[model samples]
Target: MHITVYGDTLCAQVTATAMAQTGHQVLWCLVEPESREQLAKGRPLFREQGLDLLFADQLESGRLTMDFWEGNPQGLTDAVFLALQPGQHGLAAELTKSLASSTSTGCGVIVNQTTGPVGSAELLRDIAKQIDPRAFLVALPDLIQEGNAFQTFTRPDSILLGCEDGEGEALVRELLRPFNRRKDVIQVMSLREAEFAKLAISGILATRISYMNDMASLSESLGVDIDVVRVAMGADPRIGEAYLYPGCGFGGPGLSSNVLALVDALNERAAEPGLLERVLRTNERQKEVLFRKFWQFHQGSVAGKKVALWGVAFKPGTHRVDNAPALKVIEALWAQGVKVTAHDPRALADLGQWAQGRGELTLCDDPYEAAEGADALMLITEWKPYWSPDWQRLKRVMREPLILDGRNIYEPAFVREQGLVYRGIGR
Candidate 1:
């Protein structure tokens, strides 16, 4: 099959590469300057585990090709994928219309992988069918996790497919046959239902995280460990272990936007007060938990203190910092006239760009260097390297030996035994 993937999103890159690897001839149309430059220089558009090598291999094999997005689809393309970012509805619609208007018999499936409103897929489908009777628009909402996107797409637990017609469903199934080999994981549903389900999944997961943060807060007052409670809760057959860990907060382009999209839907319908709004509120407050702890530790004398941050990315294995808890914590520290030095394995470049004109932030190449002369060390993102650090060196270099474990990755007893004062989220 000849496929054309549209957009500069991570999803677009992954889909283009994965499809090409599966014996399809794919043309990836990049809209962003960075994406086009990277591909022209024979580099993967974004860094993901194993994505670079695989994408390079596909390009070398002539299975995957790169082109600029010009609101046009290739004449020989069998399927067109719109894996665009959220809120790019106009671009998505224009591309879909262009593909549908094609006079050739090559264009068949317009896979809508972009996250949008509940009725977005249906709207695209209507526009496509109105122009070309043979064109099929199906929704396969983006469910890929950033850090582990390739694995999740290749070995998905389940797949949600939204298609109203048999021809469209069959074509999409054929396209996904290479990955959907382990006992048919695709769940067929109406277009609107699939879009709503994606948002609802994010909403429920956010609820779980916020619920655990609330429990963590209460546990601190009750003199108990949230980790112990979390383990016991996971042992139950009804409650799985996913998203149960208490942390500062959860943030990313996908989860945060999906939850907010769901909230907007509720507001549009004028629904009664619900748990999702509160869930978002709790998450925002949780982002500041580490800063609050630091302030209280010094008895309102936070000004002119130096703080070291271990990580700033939203999570490990990705360089994105959108809506990351570290951003909120940094802002809080800045408001109190605190100097912050931060280090992350991959996020320093992005963190540096985000810090432009906002305030002064020192970026360190070495994690230990970030801790030098700091009053306290705050572990915002649980990057793998941050899990185990030289406690003695941290104690020696810091003006104050205080460790604020925002992710609860450190054991309270062990940290204290290192001769450093330890403060954890629900310890």
Candidate 2:
């Protein structure tokens, strides 16, 4: 199959690369010149695990090509994947019209992989009908994670195809057959149902995380270890273990934004408030957990102190710092006349760009360099390197041997044995 992926989002890039790998010729069109230039230089606009290599390989094979979407795009593809961002639904509709105008046969499936609000597919279909009634439209919401986007897209747990027409469903299923090899992972449904299902999944995941974080706060007050509770809870066959870890809240553009979109969707449709609003509220407070702990540990005074952070990305294996908890912690520290030295395997460059003119932020390449002369160390993101460090060296380097384990990746007893005061969430 020859497919055209519209937009420059991570989902679009991953979809293009993965489709090309599965022996399909993929044309990735980006309206943004900078993003296209980055791809032209064989680099992904953002960092994702194995994305750089996969994209490079696909481009090298000539199976995947990228260009600007400047004109009509109808005969150029057997199918079109609309992978635009949340607020780009209007642009997607416009592109669909252009594609419809150029197609002499007026045949092609438009797959909606954008994370737009519910009923978005219906709107696109209505718009397509105005141009070419023969053009098929379907909703296929993307489920790619930031750091693990390639794996998630390549080996998705399930694939949802929102199509009222049999032909459109069959076309999408054939395109996704490569990823659904282990089992029958395709779920056929109406466009509205598929859009709502995607949002509901995000809402449920966010609820679980915020629920655990809420429990972590209670456990901290009651002197209970959230880790022990988390283990026992995961043992339950009904509850399961995924998204159950308590930490400094969940960040990332997709998860957080999806929850808010769900909230807005509910508010638009109902008079009553939605539960997801509370989930968003809980996560906002949870992001400040480390700062609150640090404030208490220092007896409400942290003036003129130097703090070190191990990871600044929202999560490991990526350099995305959008709405990251570490940013909140850094802001809190800096507001109180504290200097922050942060180190991440890949996020420092982006973080530095975000922190430019913020004053008192030092981006370091080495973790040990970040720890140098720090009053305390906070493990913000649980990167693999931060999981096991030279504890003795860390203790010797810091001005004060205080460790705030935001992710609870370290054992309290072992950290304490190194003569450092260790504080973990709910432990």
- Per-model CA lDDT versus the true structure: 0.90, 0.88
The C-alpha RMSD in Å for every predicted model, in order, reads 1.5, 1.5
Off by over 4 Å in 1: 37-44
How well is each residue in 1-427 modelled by candidate 2, as lDDT tens digits?
A: 8898988898898999999999998888887777867768876687787898888899999999878878667355788898988898779888877877774533468898988888889999988878777778999988888889999988989777889999888888888888899999888899999998998999999999999999999998898999999999999999999999999988888998888889998899899998888898899898888888888888988998889999999989888899999988888888898988999999998899899888768889899999999988999999998898999999889999899999999999999998899998889
- Give a tens-digit lDDT track for model 1, residues 11-119: 9988998899999999988876777676678755567767778888998999998888665566687788999889999888888788888776478788999999899
Q: Give the Å error, residue 300, model 1.
A: 1.3
| TM-scores for all predictions | 0.97, 0.97
The parts of candidate 2 lying over 4 Å away from their true place are 37-43, 104-107
In candidate 2 the C-alpha lDDT for residue 215 amounts to 96
Query: How many angstroms is residue 75 displaced in model 2 relative to the true structure, after the best TM-score fit?
Result: 4.4
